[model samples]
Target: MQDMLVRLLDLPDVSEEENKLFEKEGVVFKKPITPEKSIVVDWVGEHFSKNWADEALAAFASLPVNCFIAQREQEILGFACFESTAKNFFGPTGVLPHERGKGLGKILLIKSLRALKEMGYNYAVIGGVGPTSYYEKVVSAKIIEKSERGIYKNLLKHSK
Candidate 1:
């Protein structure tokens, strides 16, 4: 098995100001979901295509999930949603627009992995991810499947 890190710990210790900013003004950590807050969730679907939003929302709703919101004083910085499959596997993971490349992605990804492992999943697989090689380096994800989307290549993974 590739030493793919399926089980991980990604909780970041928030700086006091960041904690206060989130606590008193906005959401800092993971919390329960409600439709009201859904409006605040920004997916880059508009960039990819208007339909991307619905697709992302649909996938998030279909699985066992926990949504994380990162805001600083009521301004939404980023968010990530995690979903688990029947075999204790974690499926689709997403980060909102304006949040890419920040340390938050890595944090949420690790935390989600850790949670799935705790739920008794031995591995986690992700499909429809672009630039699979990038994730492979950061999280030790091994590609188990691949597909083509026009000129783009999509990768699937089975992580340890």
Candidate 2:
């Protein structure tokens, strides 16, 4: 998989509209505090992958903790994190399978990207991208040429 680049300054302002939709569905977007770290990590592990959970753990330790969550009356529906696997990286985001298409993913993504922009980043690298069209449509992300395998080249594999 190739990496993609997003010009943070060119991102569209969709948080406001997305927030309204989220509020209507009783979903709240927020950054996890110290006490909520374990809860968020556990949820990510269960709903996404252990790899993402590990990345979320790293995000929790960052200077400003570049991660966000979507919850409704206490249950986590989605999460997005940046500067976890690497600095100026936006990734490891996912929404629960059952909760897909509710716009939670987009909201979480925009919120996280906005945070990156606020952190003085002019661009963000969406490393090892999965859904190319989705990222392109949402943030105008462009593929970094000849970047197949990007930073995951030496990733270890488990033996069966």
Candidate 3:
């Protein structure tokens, strides 16, 4: 899949929708604290992949931390990270398979993109997108022309 670009300035207001999910599902959203890093990484590794876990670790190294997570009653349900795979980049996000229909992924995505905007970025790149339709519908993201593989053009795969 190709990478997508999000114009941060044109993002729709997500607070109301996010708050509704929070109230109805009791899910909380926030950046993982230093003490929660290892737990978050381990969760990502188990549910997603080790590579994404490593990127989450890099996000923690940033001053304000570039990752956001969704949890309910102290159990993580999903996560999203930016400025990990690349600067002004949003991704490596995933929601638990069981929680797919809820708005958790949307919350995590917009929260991270908003964070990037607050960091002075007018636009954010979502590298190597998987759910293209989701991004397009939620943030009006558009695919970057001829950017299939994009920054991961020469990515090395692990030998099994």
Provide the overall lDDT of each model, using Cα atoms, as 2-decimal numbers: 0.48, 0.86, 0.90
Off by over 4 Å in 3: none
Once model 2 is optimally superposed onto the true structure by TM-score, how far is the C-alpha of residue 87 displaced, in angstroms?
Answer: 0.8
lDDT of 3 by residue, 60-105 (tens): 9987788999999889999999999889999889999999988888
- Per-model TM-score versus the true fold: 0.56, 0.93, 0.95
List of clashing residue pairs for candidate 2: none
* Candidate 2 C-alpha lDDT tens digits along 1-160: 8899999887777767677867688888888888888999989887777778889999989766789998899889889999899989998899888989878888888888989999999999998997699999989999999988677788764333
Model 3 residue 5 CA deviation in Å: 0.8
- lDDT against true structure, model 1: 0.48
Ranking by TM-score: 3, 2, 1
Report lDDT (Cα) of residue 88, candidate 3.
97
| Tens-digit lDDT string for candidate 1 (22-118) | 4565546554355524553344243343333443364356434344545555554554444522233333444555656655556556555666666
